[model samples]
Target: MSQDLYELSATELSASYAAGLDPREVAESVLARIADREPVLNAFYVHEPEQVRRDAEASAKRWASGTQLSAFDGVPATVKENIPRSGIPVPSGTALANPPVSAENAPVTDRLLEAGLVLLGSTTMPDWGMLSSGVSSRHGITRNALDPSLTTGGSSAGAGAAAAAGYGPLHVGTDIGGSIRLPGTWAGLVTLKPSAGLVPLHAPYMGRAAGPLTRTAADAAALMSVIARPDIRDYSTRPYPSMDWFKGPANPAGLRVGLQLDAGSGAEVDPQIAAAVQRAADLFAAAGAHIVELRPFMSQAQLAGIDAFWRTRSWADYSALEPEQRENVLPYIARWCAGGKDYDGVATMVHYNRFAQVQQETIAATRDYDLVLSPVAPMAAFPAEQPMPVDDPDLPMAHISFTMPYNMSGQPAATVNCGFMLDGRTIGLQLAGPVGADDKVLAAAVWFESVRGDAALDWARVL
Candidate 1:
């Protein structure tokens, strides 16, 4: 292959290993790439090249003896800093909490290690995983690899940068709201937020799931095949059968695909992103699928209510901290949590109830369609120094309206690059499906990847 080992996809690396390529060599290539890019991107909180080399040596031995643990045995990969790996401290993107080293691996980490992936290190995230931008108090800002001045959307900030910079073939990120997809959008990658509980997590929340960020949808599916397993640890884990996640392109012909151009709340969609989504819809229609225009299913009241609930949840955590520790938090995050401090019982209950309402509305609106297409975010990547798209703590969530509803609804959602902005930033097209439709959503993503020909990106020259 013309590309270097570090540039290979996970599937490609697997094949090369099967053909007798040594994992150690691949490991060195990735280490060099990381060293070259890390200074500007600041993508990882932990990156130990010696440890990576040792793991790669072991994988090389396994391959040499015809006893490779898995097809992905030695492929480079990263986990978000928030996901605990036994013996590693999870800072949750804040400097305030001095977390003890974890005694056990997060379920996602267990699966990644078990599959024999070379653990590159933990990636950076924003304070408390609250902001959509990459600014963090603990690890500093993670810039977009494609364009350093721009934000690598978070809280999957570093994971996005790592994947885009070819630091690895697989990166695990958790999505509660739009964390995974938003970064995937701005960073130009394939990312998934599985149906809630489909990928069991360590400390599961309402809409959080562990998923992959890779350059290709197929690579995302390859990573999903390992991580989306049942773990007794997550009470919310769904009872799902083992799936053939790499099944070929889904037949789009005769499928009913919904086009959602309006989020109905928050920031208005940028013209470039809106047009890109429409182009995606046109491609689906051209491929023989029925494209239906969808009415906005979410309202500003619903968005505000959910925002209020989140603020309180975060404030509760902040209020419990010592004053100095609380002061250590990012100022933007502090301001955002301040709104949660004074909610009365009635107001709190009303805000909490919005989740059920949002969920119900999302499911009801999409029940008639096999898939729905929309923009992953309202606009392209923002300034890296900013805390959020709007740069206002009071309006921190203005850009998440398009991607947050699916998290509440527990639907499977994905972001795939469909186009690019004139300034060269990526425009992500989001594809969502009804709850329990992980396979369908992923398959559709793969199909789209095949049809969305030649994105014309060159990461080699990006830096």
Candidate 2:
């Protein structure tokens, strides 16, 4: 029963409580599984077993009384460490910890609690959500579920690893530049980076957005419907009507998808990844969607400007840290930050102007299409401990070339596991839609999942 309980989806888990499966037993099974696997996977920063059991017992009562709070009642979930939850210390994956526990939940955390999703614990991340690799100063490396030798992609590293390892059905991760999508792609999971203002964020950064990483598209939608609600704390948030994302587009018959093989950064895609993206496009084309090949929407100069903008933000944060505290940071991130310190106000404005231009061009390029498709990363998962792909340390953003554009445009984007590489590492197909078109992007993802089937979820269960 314990093993079987661990295998159920969030929807399945909730339904099972009424079908004679005790929530307490399910919680214990999850705790036992975590105890056995945490040392090897390093997927969690903390797990409160006693608290989890208490919550499960209460949830079970709700079920017994036919008073379940929501569809996710008693369904296990994990939140990325960067997001604040009441009583949880958000170290932001850094060595400098013992930060005070949050007094209240961030909007996303509050919604999860309100929806009755049982949080297992906070997952790990890179220092200050800095790097794409899953290695962090506090928790070390979060290994990939499929191949432990490879990285799980970060800074949403632990969330991706936990979801891929079947720790739970839903995990929340934050993305500034591909944090959620990259990890989800590398870990063979479904993830979304909702349009910037669609999901409220408390972070000081402008582009960062919180979203869901799950095994199925429907699960991602379920979590998003709750997390994307407007919050007064986030002044930038805009009210969006509730959506039924589980019932996505019935088919791709009327969707227009623009397929981009490269972003014109001069970096070549690994042949295997390109082939997989092509296959995904072919599948959509065959399903009655009109597929159009897209040219580079932004020039190399514009792309580089976006990279500089991110580094400039990092520089501000890093420079403010005490000198001793900075010394404890990852060398790669520290060096990246140091490089940005020389940019003057005029240079910053120039980059901002370029960023705006890039955003305009992206919107213009996709105006004719319902969504755009590309490879989530240029290559498959690399070694677990490295900050960037071993051969391209100087070009740190190369791996996220296809993903950062949407982040800059403030458009919704999602990654779906398309197929596996010859080395067994998974590849992801990225889907990006116009600003405020999150539902359309998700609908297309669900349609693709229908075609591809839930093979990734099935594979992860046995890992």
Candidate 3:
């Protein structure tokens, strides 16, 4: 089980020790690789070098005694900046969102560490982690690994780029509305948005959940077992499953699959993306699942509007900033939510009710299908420095139009790369499941992986 620096999966690296590779050597090799790439990628926001060295040093001892913590033992991983890292501010991707660095590890980070993965550092993010384009005025924008000219999807931009650029195999990324999936799609990696409440969210804004962004869907399953523990800090999280995401126990045969061919965005989907989705559908049919193309029941406006409650993000994020630094925040976000503006207490409740109604209707409509499939991001990546090409003349880009609905409904969802667009950018297919169906979603993603395998595009080949 000897492995090269970059090719082994997170699970494989842990398994290598069982087959004879020294876990400490693998850990050291990962550190060297991170040092080699950090300058070019700029992926981390707050890295803990001495702490990580100590953790790896301890893991090295465990390796010699043949008493590793588990399969992911000694594996290197990074957390998004907003997730509390015990000493870093929850800088939610915006300059205004950073308060003092935290003094204790957040529940999610504490659980993951207890599972044996060393936290290398915090990955960079968009301010408040809300901006869809992945640009951070405070920390320079994260560029797509495939094409520096293209924007990395956010607000999990750094996690996405870090994986594609060879920083690590497993990392955690939150997704309210495509934050995890879009970045993974744009950067050509696999990501999971577990059902709300499966992964605990102790942050005030995240309410009650979180998820993983990884190189493969199988990695997501491994991460779920690590981070899905109940947290008294966030009472809403469910009890950790005795065993989660172990595949082959359930059969995929005759599963009814629904493909939302058009996601009500009204934007003209690039033909290449549509073709890639169709190919995925054909493959599913050949594998014995029944695939049906259906017009989805939800609309973009209805889904986007759900942010009123979930994304009080702007206000929840920026209001905590110092008065003077507030002006330096991202202009659009600051202007929209600053000065004690935006919503009154009453309006906020009404908005929440309206959003809930939409969720009820969407869930009722989608219940018949075991898995619902759609394109991850309607459009492909754009330049890193510019705003998305919204005024493309032929089509206007409404970022998050396709992803926000699941956030509203609080469903478990994920992205799987299927093919490359004509422009050479990657296209991903999203697979979603009912709320509380976290294991089911990961199982389907793994089944999708067993069939399509990994994506074919290489960074050097495209950008």
TM-score of 3: 0.90
Better of 1 and 3 by TM-score: 1
Among the numbered candidates, top lDDT falls to 1
All candidates in order of lDDT, best leading: 1, 2, 3
The lDDT for every candidate, in the order shown, is 0.90, 0.82, 0.72
| Displacement of the residue 177 alpha carbon in candidate 2, Å | 1.0
Using TM-score, give the best candidate's number: 1
What residue pairs are clashing in model 3? 92-128, 93-126, 93-127, 94-127, 94-128, 151-382
Q: How many clashes does each candidate structure show, in the order listed?
A: 0, 0, 6
Reference-based TM-score, model 1: 0.98
User: What C-alpha lDDT, on a 0 to 100 scale, does residue 214 get in candidate 2?
Assistant: 87
User: What tens-digit string does per-residue lDDT give for candidate 1 at 375-418?
Assistant: 99999999999888887777537888888999988999999999
In candidate 2, what are the lDDT values of residues 1-463, reduced to their tens digit?
5446666777677667768677788888788777877788899998888889888898889888988888778888899998888877888887874655788888888888887778899999988787887888788888887678889999899998888877868899999878999997898888999987888776536667899998877778878877888888888886666656776654788788899997877367989989988998998989898999998776778866777777888889889888898877777777776767899999988877876787788888878988899998888899997877644434536666688778777889999999888867888999998878787788888888888753344563445
- Backbone clashes counted, model 3: 6
Q: Residues 120-148, candidate 3, lDDT per residue (tens digit)?
A: 88888876665666678777878777777
